[model samples]
Target: MTAPIFPLSAVVGMDDLRLALVLNAVSPAIGGVLVRGEKGTAKSTAVRALAAVLPAVEVVSGCRFSCDPADIDPDCPDGPHDFAGPRESRPARLVELPVGASEDRLVGALDIERALAEGVKAYEPGLLAAAHRGLLYVDEVNLLGDHLVDLLLDAAALGMSYVEREGVSIRHRSRFLLVGTMNPEEGELRPQLLDRFGLTVEVAAPREVDARAEVVRRRLSFDADPTSFAAGFSAAESELASRILTARELLAQVALPDAVLRQIASVCASFEVDGLRADIVIARTAVAHTAWEGRSVVDGDDVRMAARLALPHRRRRNPFDAPGLDEEQLDNALDDHSNDDDPHDDGPGGAPAPQDSPAPADSSSPTDSGSAPERPMPAPGESFAAPTDTFRTRRLEVPGVGSGAAGRRSRAKTDVGRVTGSSRPTGKAGRLHLVSTMIAAAPQQKARGRTSAGLILRRQDLRLARREGRESNLVLFVVDASGSMAARSRMGAVKGAVLSLLLDAYQRRDKVGLVTFRGDSAELALPPTSSVDTAAARLTVLRTGGRTPLAAGLLRAREVLRVERLRDPRRRALMVVVTDGRATRRGGGDLEDAYRTAALLAAEGTAAVVVDCESGPVRLGLAGKLAMALGGPAVRLEELAADTLAASVRTFTGAA
Candidate 1:
């Protein structure tokens, strides 16, 4: 049995989040709201609670697609026009979006039942249809499929869904509150999709001991006796619902002055936010907030609150940059609007005011009233974070044996066994043109006297499947962390270089693993992962000492790559070894053994790069020799910056 929802009021702290959700609930025209935080932040709980408290929606009775009663379509499958029933009010629904949902399943598809039973073309509304006039909740939305994300963005933007499949083309209203929850650590949404959300809320775990204890207490109480616990908050829930209803009724009457709109645009311009979407979203949310407060007119406070939610994701140039809105700057912008005649205030298209500008105390939270601290500029010749553009458009091409997964490659004969249901004939192996096939078979079914058999099947009807060109690669980083090479600066440089290459690995759609050799033998310091954060965590506190054991590290990397190849032969492996080829294997170590293993790597056709970090006048050139044996080029340690090294490796592997 499903557990009862925890009341929104009982949610401890997260005043910012609660208010954002309430505003969106009051006025979904604010687009949708995104909740970003670490795990266990009650992101999902808050979304569900919003659903539970939402006012009932009046939908056409027996409408399979949940069509609005006021705007019922005449061609609905249930025949609302011919034998329509009275409109009925139903509780607002919470529709969960599955991560692996297909495009057909997300949008509507051709109804197989009606087609097979009655030889009639019909539509089967998907989740998008069911979510009309309701909440479409997506948890871990960042991890959702890319195609699905695109579909959602288009649907949310248009407030209607359009689907063409199996000779059936249909479009229907799909307006809904798109509430998405994501742990920023897991991954990220594309900027295009990110900006689609009208508001974004960042939540943190309760810091106060008392507040944390309260959260645990309420959670335990709810889990132990949900019925009794929910009963306790019933009155509060009902009141909140009524407030939302009143807010909706008052939304149309809420006033946003021309000055307020200018202030909104000026604030976005100050932040250099891209496009005018931020300005529009802020205006809509400000109006929603005004309605929520039972106020007739939007004030500076409403705009500030709206900016807090709408500007974060939109203003950022990169995903990793902190979500920022200098409260002092924003307040000055609002203040400047009051005095548009002042020349100094309009410095360089309204230059940002002094950082020391005082901020008015927020009535909601005293602790959050202070002006936000300015973002620290990076020092000269220093890098803060990797730019997404560096990796976003890059693709890694692995050697292909035949038709395989989806990516960039020449089309080959398709494997019928691997055929997916998608109608888009990717590559050259997919079945005959889907549209043409449907058209060819459409008119002859009735004359053939087998209409009830659901069209016709024959060998000639079978179209050859097309192959999709998808490629994936794995990068294994083998680093030497022996005491001889553990100089703090050397290790730091090595770590930085690896991080740079990892960015390329991410862009190439490749998995990465790290192996470190020190002490007795080599150890797999980090497992294969696509997440840069995961690799960074393992590299930060990596210990460095003991014998080199280059042989053991080489053997370990070879074994790992071998296993990976066995699992998926199509995935190519590239080993980038960061080491100064000095070897002193603990008990059974041998320099010759390492050289032999390097040759074996070459024999196995595994791409390799040996970064020679041996910086001394009296160098033995063992790293150069190792690189030769492995049939890969050696890169000088001094030449191993992120971009340079990534380009060098990509050029070497032909993956650029």
Candidate 2:
């Protein structure tokens, strides 16, 4: 028997999340809600409980596709239903889409043999069909394959699934309430996917002792005896459900006034979100909010409430950014939107905005609050400097292919992505190349005296599809914070470069570690982990000073990678060293020691990059020499930018 779900009414805190869920339920036209929070935050619990408060759906009895009795879908696979057939009422289902789900499992598939041989179309319904007219929940949504996510978003946007495979085509209504829950620390979803979500909210565990205690109390009680625990909250659940039903009925009658319409436009414009989707979502959510409040019209308050839920994901620029709107920023946008129109959208004929300002920070955390502290003067080997404005760095990928976690860098052998070719199964292949297997078996079939039933397939004839996809690497950053370069701008630029790389790692699903060498010693500032946010935090407060220990840094990086490889042998490592180059003499670590260490790394075939932080017209090209030893590329600071990268980035056989 399935365990009873914890009641939505029993959830202790998360007012924003609860409200967002209710609003989406009230108006699925709001698109869908993406809930982002840390683990143990009840994100999943709240989503599952949503089914309890949802009104039961009535469908044509015996219809496999869950077709509505009154509005039967003509295109439904199980169609041609009798209008006079018995009807059945059932609670809305909550179908789950697993992270590892394949395209065939999502949009349905065809029986290949029947379609190819018998010239018959046999369609097997997938999760999209199962979720029709119900709720579809995806857990660990960020970890889901990019292609699967695209398919999901496409179906959700179109409100239908068109599955055509092996000459068999099937189409059906797939409208549902898409509720996805993700822990930001695991990884980030693509920007394209983020924008598709109608509303986004960030939740954290309740800070209040009493609220936390209540959460534990209720959870324990439910675990002890789910039946009795759920029964106790039955009345409250029903009342909430009834309210939702009433809200749904009243939603069509709610008025969205011109003032509110303009307000929605103004808020989206002020936030400067890309595309018109945000505006539309805000408008829809505003109407839902009005109904939830038992009100007739969307007022200014309702508009703000809608923006609060709808604008977060739209404005996000990076993975580490906390997913929510700053109350002050939102108010300022709404209060001054009349004149605040795009800070850059001005001048006669919409003249180009001024281009002289230093670029916005790529390293700074958007969510960090409180004023920074004053930095004390550096002693022998340490200095404090704010990060320089980060730029769009060049793509620093590990050369060749690898078998690792799915990512956007370095070629990988994966199940997803386009089929590159076919290869015989080495051990257990990723995906089977049906056509290739048939081709390999065709000639042998006649030799084996095949009958008319079908071509006999032998175990040795199996062919697995070879696919080339990108895999995330373990990015180990070796930063030089020695006294040789301690100026704020110099160190800041170097710090900014590291910060920029960290952002890339976060987006590419790479685990990262930081190693800083100064004052005759190298220290592991941060260990390799999926949480890039933590690495960013450590970088923001990083202090630099002391003699440069270039050799020590390389040695430490090798050690870190060695340990990481043991834990996860499949994941590859890419070492990124940030420095002006050349080990300091009259004493720091020996330049020869550094070179030898670099050579060792190169011998190991470790993909590496040497970011030459050297500034000014006059230079020794010491960093280039170091890059040569590492057998990677030597990219200068100016050359690291997206615009200048292609022209100036040089591949170093051994040059730093």
Positional deviation of residue 396's Cα in model 1 after best superposition, in angstroms: 1.9
State the lDDT of candidate 2 residue by residue for 90-153, as single tens digits: 9898999998777778887765576446535578789998898889999999898776877898
lDDT of 1 by residue, 1-656 (tens): 56778999889999999999999999999988899998999999999999988999987777766777667766555554433567789988889898766566788677766764565777888999889889999998876655677789888998878887677777777889999998866555657778889999999998899999999999999999998999899999999999999999999999888878877887776676779889999999999999999999998899999998998787554422335566677777777676676533645666654433444233121112222222245344322222112222233233333333322221222332223444433344544544344555667666667734466644444444333433435778998888767776776666666655665554334567999887678889877765644564455446677778899999999989888878777656768899998899656646899999999999988778899988868988989999999988788887765456657656665553
Model 1 misplacement above 4 A: 1-3, 69-86, 323-393, 401-474, 478-501, 504-511, 514-530, 533-595, 602-656
TM-scores of the candidates are 0.72, 0.87
Error (Å) of candidate 2 at residue 354 is 19
Model 1: number of backbone collisions: 10
Candidate 1: RMSD to truth:
7.9
- Measured over all alpha carbons after superposition, the RMSD of each candidate to the real structure, in angstroms, is 7.9, 4.8
Give the Cα-based TM-score of candidate 1 against the true structure. Answer: 0.72
